[model samples]
Target: MPARTPWIRTFLCRSDNIGVLMRDPETGACAAIDVPEAAPVLAALKETGWTLTDILVTHRHADHVEGIPEVKRATGAKVTAPAKAGAAVPEVDVTVSEGDTVSVGALAGEVWETPGHCADHVSYVFAEAGVVFAGDTLFTLGCGRVLEGPPETLWRSLSRFLPLPDETQIYSGHDYVGSNARFALAADPDNARLKARAEEAQRAAAEGRFLIPSSLGEEKATNPFLRAGDPALAQGVGLAPGSEAERVFVALRAWKNRF
Candidate 1:
């Protein structure tokens, strides 16, 4: 557990993407993980009455950085992005790499270079806070596409999360849980746990609820991409039982590409 309590607020933007506001209870310091748009982010800051202190950008995609300039103008927050991104994102006050540290008031977190979703993509994990801003690299029941790398690189990036404590909470870049759940069920049809989750995800979407903040533990069980090494997953995808983990992983990504 964190020395200071961590407060996270999740909201949607552009009808699909997930935007977040993080506050450190001890210092009243706040940060936005990725800004899909500005209206809701501004509104959340207003509602919480917390002054923004920083912008932690996960990737250089337009949807992630499109609202950065506007939000920065409004909050005057310092912006940090992947060092490799260079000029890809606007107004980077700090460019960080694999081992960089990000601080919010007295609270701090580590940078993780996750470039498979796109070259120079990154994610942040405040281990003490027990949370991660996964950006587009990972989601509830799915992961990002291989736009900039092969399945092997993505597998390595995704594998980084497996060693984290099960209690770590995941905040994703988008609200694609419903569709990911459908694809998971298709590939791993006999997974009763997945069957139950698919129905739950469908019901939640039907009721218009946000499904972005799932735990790493839940993802271990429900995300087939994460379970690609399991013999069961290999067979589910019609691979021979002893096929390599990367093979199952590559096949899974291919199936998701068409999903």
Candidate 2:
């Protein structure tokens, strides 16, 4: 069942990618975030019968923006993308940046610049809907590979959203939850929350399901990436019990890269 307020539809795309829709039932307006592919977005639009009013692009990766032209051509929706990333994406009618506000009918979204996976990556926070489309920067129990970094750069991006309200929910670009779970367990073997989350992800993956719409509070308690500062994690990693948070985080990222 769709939520009562802003009804969100999750579209599973090619490979493990995802495309999402946030619909305002009262206004009958829908905003599509990061078109991984057009067919799935179009299918979802048809299934929901919602009018596409806006397309918010989070990053410039081909897999994320390749379907933009097709979807915009079909719906005539206004397309918004990061100003720095506009050159790499297609049909960006409006270029936005951090603190910029975007509207989908009556709904509003705040743009957050979360680069690391790529130099031009951005994430969209639909404050009214309590959701953030983290693109490739942040995931369920993992983060994007530092394709363009010093580890600190990516760590900064991943840590930016930590201050969001506890109720904030995260929707990422791909379904890597199960594998991330395994990695988290390997690193933080004794965390009850991590163990339970790992088991849940295993069961869900076994059933061919993705664990998404992960809440910020849930992440705070279980996600090792976000818990890099925890003394327990530092001890687990043998990086000195009182190491700096950023140091612990860097070590964790290094370990994850090799994992």
Top candidate on lDDT is 1
Q: What is the lDDT of candidate 1?
A: 0.89
Model 2 lDDT per residue over 48-155, tens place: 888898888888889888999999999998989999885898899999988898887777778888888888888888766788889888899888888886888888
lDDT of each model, Cα atoms only? 0.89, 0.86
Model 1 residue 57 CA deviation in Å? 0.2
Give the poorly placed runs of model 1, Cα more than 4 Å off.
1-3
lDDT of 2: 0.86
Model 2 spans with C-alpha error above 4 angstroms: 1-4
Top candidate, metric TM-score: 1
Tens digits of per-residue lDDT for model 1, 83-105: 88879899899999997999987
